[model samples]
Target: MSLTVDIQFKRSSKIYHQGPISLINQSVEVTKSGKIPPGQTEIPFELPLSPRSSSKTLYETYHGLYVIVQYSLRCDIKRSLLAKDVSKLQEFIVEYRPSNGETDEKKAVKFEIRPETLQNVRDRARIPQFLVRGHLDSAVFPLSKPLTGELTVCECERGISSIELQLVRVETCGSAEGHTKEASEIQNIQIGEGDVCRGMAIPVYMVFPRLFTCATTIAPNFKIEFELSIVIIFDNDHLVVETFPIKLTRN
Candidate 1:
């Protein structure tokens, strides 16, 4: 038995589509191009990657209603010619959001999480003892600006032990067939632990990179979503997580 591996940057149609179309913008294969025996895999291996002159490296991984700009690595295992072969495909992401540098734009963005908003996770039969709420100072921020907000935790059993904030970009792509979805992290920060007491208020601040990150957008093939996630961890091992979606456009 033997194995071969390859990585590729490509624009491809969703799976299951008849006559699927794909453009292999770039591909890099391991230099050791022989069906090396599995037993010989003890040696280290390195592969070179290069893009075509006309090909463009991804600015942002996009999932469109009909297509996807996908980055993937594939591994193929081969055995006797009469035997069947096996292959595996893994998808990855590229992100381009930069950090808050210097910008004069300042705008306020507020998010309200009422009890009703927490219904999906909260048991309707039992009342929740705590509520997690927060709001960013600005709805639209440059990468250089801190995503500043105030967090309030209404707790009945002491206060929350930890608070976490993250900026994420979610993309979905597919058609009449099926769909593939991916979420990439733009920025994440743990606000660290605080006093475990009721009525705890914490001010949040963090910045995301601006390199390849772009403003929020939607298309038939895919949509880019930005969100702030608040996680409340308790000393008792219970968890409360809330997500507040936001627009990442400039003022």
Candidate 2:
């Protein structure tokens, strides 16, 4: 069976001060899969940084900017079984580019902000609308094996002005029983403010498992269903959340 995976980044807020708001750079890739080329799919481009006039703050902001990124992935399984196990995919990379006549290959600056520093600007640095899309293929897997994949956002830099990482949340759902209640939480490793320097990319990775364990005894001809969603929050109030769907059929 054929499966499709869709990914998107949407920014919901912005606070630009003492600088021009141009483009928001983003990239996506399938770093790992059970039977397909891991790093073969990529979509790199920029989104216009057009914020509503009402979304701006009037403070003497040291770093008056915020953004949010949302991402999602979906897949299909050709075979169904009473019980199955899934493994986490590995890391993927994402980077940002400035439109001020800079090279796309420019290195990113690293900065880490303390929790206290982030708390000060948490309300001001909100992400408004950042989104991107892509897909993955799972046609080569055998009935005994399942399809798995991973996606990640690389470190993003905004010149001398620093961007902060605030919060990250992920959710999943599907036709399979209790699939919606499966929550895998990652421990947040706090990086100090200004630690991620300008022109550099911060990497966040998400691994996807291909198999779903059956909730009860079932027939061999029945189908198994699944869905997944990921949400990321930045200091600037920007948020990115994407959802993916998958189905396992009887062979």
How big is the positional error of residue 202 in model 1, measured in Å on the Cα after superposition?
1.8
Overall lDDT per candidate, in order of appearance? 0.55, 0.28
**TM-score of every model versus the real structure:** 0.52, 0.23
Model 1 C-alpha lDDT per residue in residues 94-204, reported as the tens digit of each score:
555564566546556555554466646644433346565556786666544567878776544444566678777665554555555666666668885764444566788
The local lDDT score (0 to 100) that residue 168 gets in candidate 2 is: 20
**Candidate 2 lDDT tens digits, 1-251:** 11111122222222211222212223333333344447785434333333235423111101101111212122233223663644333222222222245322322222233223233333444433222222223322222334333222334432122222222222232222322322332222222233233333344322322222211112121222233333344554453434344332222
TM-score of 1: 0.52
What is the alpha-carbon lDDT for the whole of candidate 2? 0.28
Candidate 1 residue 149 C-alpha distance from true site, Å: 1.4
